[model samples]
Target chain A: MTTGQRIDTVFTLFVRLLLAGIFAFAAYMKLRNPAAAQAFAESIQGFKLLDPLQHHHLTVLATFAVPWLEILCAAFLILGFWTRAASFAMLGAMGVFIWAISTVIERGMNLQCGCFGEFSFPCGDTIGMCHLVRNSILAAGCLYLVIRGGGRVSIDRLLISGKPKVERLGATPTPTPTPTPSATPTRPVSSRPASDDTPIALDPVRPTPLSSSPSGVDAAQPPKPRWD
Target chain B: MRFVGRVALILILATVAATVHSLYWPIYRDLPDRQARTQRAPVTDAAAQDGSPTPTGRSELPEHYISVARAYQFWEEGMPFVDARTAAERVVGTIDGAIHLETRNFIDGSATRLLEELDRAFPVIVFCGGGECDASENVAIRLSGWGFNEIYVMHEGYDAWKDAGYPTEAVGGG
Candidate 1:
């Protein structure tokens, strides 16, 4: 590999490892006191994005989901598995967290941020500033992955034999084929477009109508076709 | 080899610095104890012996209930009404002339100096969002322990005062 590429690889690896360690520690801290974490969740005024679930149920789910997501993304980042995807997910989560925190601070909420569960860190004015700074750095790191494609040593690179493959599945496949009778003998439809219009128009009569049949003689004759 | 190692080293050092900086702040600071010494009802028995403000011989002190009318009276009389609600709740609405003292620091003794400044005999009413909230009660209890005898818990708090046609104010500034 070129010298610049190798430098980039090393830099990316260091960031991934550092992010992984921080997330792992944060997850552990949150798991320690889920109750306090839940309370902190409720204390925020308008962070009811997960309000589809009942209050405590949402709280419990968040208590588990947030940390686990952090840990999983961190792990993915370190392992370089779907590096860009993982980084994007981590960035999204951090954005939501930053918004939640900023809202709390802007509204002047004095509740503890459950970043480290029951561990009370005084979130004075300085704490908000510090949170923004830290999260912004993490976001920048994630953005680097999104922009530069997961650097070397990533599973994306290793699994694809050095060639990055982009898969595209544009439209859904058609369901089933139904027989469509011709409007006239010469005009036969080959490929029907799958729009709103119906394809089939059944013929009303045959050349030899059913009334001419032997069985038709024994029974009451059927009415002649309107077109005929 | 040297370049890669140097980059790795820098990354590690940066990570360590961030982590250390985040955790290095002092855990908690002890603010001065604000419980008023003179406000405490003089316990005759305790006064006869060691001259601490500790209540003596009184089985139970009266349940200090400061009604909405009384809160209004205090506000009219120029007594500062301290709202013990979280800052967010205060923004929605609060008692006029009430100073915002967050519940977190109310029990932490941060308000000790403020308490010390007030006349021991002067009335200090603590209130929260409403009766459902325990912040006012908690603040009242802490103030009582601080030996403030005239401490009153505005039972219904801001809600009751607002309902009783008393004036309300917007919370901001600090």
Candidate 2:
């Protein structure tokens, strides 16, 4: 209901859409051209993560799995379904990419990035900081998504019970505690605006409780589920 | 943590789904296998610089790969040289008296006239810009497909040839 909360919602929505569009385009570019798969495979060899000669099958596996994973994660991000999970997946991908590119640079290898498949940016003999900077920014965005759940427009907001209100920087003290699950099963309580009080599907967003931490501050943070 | 576990689950699910889909999707399957292409001869830089001495018995070179020195011998013998580099790349210059047939033009029928006039008995030496450039190998593959048996790929390509102080002709200058 507050102005700061409204701003947070808009910013979160913008980030999710921007990241989703970028990843979707990236996935499509790699998948559209079948020949690019080989180019991608050769680029992977430049990383020196695996010997192309000895572990050819692993190279093939990476070539197929990477772009497909991007598509899957990008789709989830777009729909705002499992937003944090998809963002985490993208973050992991960015981490791997940063490592791979740094390795090539460290070894003084001349290689085409083959990043956007056939539509890759022209990289001459040397790798530069531009690639690193781009991945870093994208990683930051994914990290933000993980910390802040998908905003008002997201499926997570519509479906998850007791979803937290968008937390604005330097906003008022934390809102009231969430009603106990048994106490209000029929009407799930949320800090969201009154206009968003419409009934949502009953299915739990996650298979298990993400965190047993009480609903004030700890619930708004990243999940800390105890593994038994 | 729950975040790590969730991410792991997404990755596992995505990998499994993609593996299954790849079996049928044209995107993941039917990728060009460059490994299946014809094997190329490996010539060390030192060896390429010091091409084998002309053998006494046979007039032709023994290996499909010829070094800078042997390439000169072929030049002295008046064997035809083909420049396999792209037109833009060729604008820098090329081997003196070498013929250029852009690899892309091979399928477009532009090289047919040149193909018909070739001397089958003598070997044709092919070279590109060199230093990880595969244009020469690709051209050699196409030449072999066309039944040109005596084909030699100049291992170090034109860069090595020019670096060795060999005769070269520029596009604009004589």
Q: Which residue pairs clash in candidate 2?
A: none
DockQ comparisons of all candidates to the true complex: 0.02, 0.29
lDDT of 2 at B97: 89
Tens digits of lDDT, candidate 2, A1-228? 458768877898899999988887877766664445544655666466886456866767777788888887888888888889899888988999998888877877555565676443543323556777778899999999988878778887767534333222222333344456455443323422333223332223322223453433344443332110
For candidate 2, give the DockQ.
0.29
> What is the clash count of model 2?
0
Cα lDDT of model 1 by residue, B1-174, tens digit: 643453344344434543443233211100111222224443345233743223222223224555688667768988767788876677678887676775345434467677777776666788887634545654665555556555666768787888898988777643
Residue-level lDDT tens digits of model 1 in A1-228? 346656877887788888878777777665444233323333331243444223534444455556666766677777877666667767777897788777755855444455654334443422366666677787888787766545656775666532212111212222223222243242222232211111222222222222334323332433232211
* C-alpha lDDT score of every prediction, in listed order: 0.54, 0.65
- The per-candidate count of clashes, in order, stands at 2, 0
Stretches of model 1 off by over 4 angstroms after superposition: A36-56, A118-127, A162-228, B1-174
TM-score, cand. 2 vs. native: 0.60
| Candidate 1, pairs of clashing residues | B34-B112, B39-B149
